[model samples]
Target: MIADPEGTVLALFAAFCRIGACIMVLPGFSSFRVPVQIRLFIAVAVSMALLPVMWDSIYPRVQGGGSNYLLLVGVEMLIGVTMGLIARYIVLAMQFAGTGISMAIGFNAAPGGGLLEAEPEGHITAFISFTVLFVLFLSDFHHMVIAALVRSYSFMPVGADFDPRMALMTLTDTLAGAFMLALRLASPFLVYGLIFNLSIGMVNKLSPQIPVYFISIPFILFGGLILLYFGSQSFFTLFVNGFEPLYLGLP
Candidate 1:
């Protein structure tokens, strides 16, 4: 038989690897601004705290060095990635909203950094996306993510093969729901931009000499700012509320 202490340590290390990999990509914890060393340290600390509590359940299965070991590791990775992807979709909802708002407000013309890598997005859209992501961390929603991580082992134990078809379907459904939520959040801005532009166009046609584009630019800017200020509280509340459901569903 393998030594008890060595087996325990290996199990803990394996668990930490899975958790760390997930956090590396999960929302709230996966910020480019955070130093990699700090993230690794946090992951290690979390795994250490959890190992003792979870060892009774996870140790027996992982003790033996055989085919089961590889299978368990794979399951752990799949569970971790699924959980992270669920959280990621929640953040994507915000990005979708930001993109919609930017397009409606005529700010989509300006170029900015991509959301992940090489995915082109507008400047205003990028700003809103980053702000929402930052706010998620600031609000301590990351605690929910960690909780989900710990809870996942219970729902999806080691050595059990997950259904890849179900995983794919879940991802697809989550993304579609996220996009729909974004559209809802940005609908007010879209409607306002539409109506305002239509009215301006009518006025310009009525008096072709007038410089309607120059005149209405300031109005639209001020209107958008005021709308954002008023809508921000609702937006954050909606995002947090929506995020909880998605987090809970991840397996």
Candidate 2:
């Protein structure tokens, strides 16, 4: 028979508070296309599976069952959300770089619906975002997140006070790191665009009679496309390589 069913239940919910909140904002799991019910079930299932493994850590903390328990719940959720945001911020940085690439290369075509998000995105942005997401899944990034979740209790145990300042600093660092990685990925295209535009401007100055701006558009667009096609492999490789460092570096 079960002993102290109430304590067990509390522990399970406590575990869910962390895991569920993380999944709620996690990149692929939090996509608009995923149903809320599916997310809920996935969270609950993972919580249950982990409960046994974490029993020693979680059950003792919640056995008291008082106002203190409420504080733990809130802290757990906050930690979960913070961790999820770390990953979310990185993916967002990639999207920002994609937008930059689109602008730099003169691919300002009208945006269409995004593959993962509800918001409309330019074709180049959408493609880059989707591809990055795809590569992340292919490399089992979710596994890393789950592993990190399990290890979290060791450092951020239950009943510990949530430190907003530390969380803020961690997020700020994540943003800075993510921005640097995005800039690295987009640097080549940015340089290419600058050189291409400068050359075209010189050509226009030499022959003011011709409509240089209109004529140069096709060449720049073609060159940008060619550059993207050739460099796509390196671009994604670097992105995947950098992701682990940024994520693991979080405090």
Provide the lDDT at 77 for model 2. Answer: 98
Please list the residue runs of candidate 2 whose C-alpha ends up more than 4 Å from where it truly belongs after superposition. none
TM-score for each prediction?
0.87, 0.97
Q: What is the C-alpha lDDT of each candidate?
A: 0.77, 0.93
Write candidate 2's Cα lDDT for 1-251 as tens digits.
78899999999999999999999999989999999999999999999998999899999999969999998999999999999999999999999999999988999899999988999999999999999999999999988988889999999898889999999988999999999999999999999999999998998889989898789889888999999999999999999999998988833
Candidate 1 lDDT over residue span 1-251, tens digit each: 54587788778877886688788778656766667898899889988888877777677777866776877777777777877887788787787788778766666465766754356777767777777786777778778777777777786776678778877887888887777777778889999999999999999999999999889887887888788889888977787667666656533
Tally clashing residue pairs in candidate 2: 0
Q: In candidate 1, how many Å is residue 223 off? A: 1.0
Angstrom error at residue 148, model 2: 0.6
The residue pairs in collision within model 1 are: none
Q: For each candidate, how many residue pairs have backbone atoms clashing (under 3 Å)? A: 0, 0
Candidate 2 least-lDDT 10 residues: 242-251
Off by over 4 Å in 1: 1-3, 112-123
Q: What are the RMSD figures for all models against the true structure?
A: 3.0, 1.2
Name the top TM-score candidate. 2
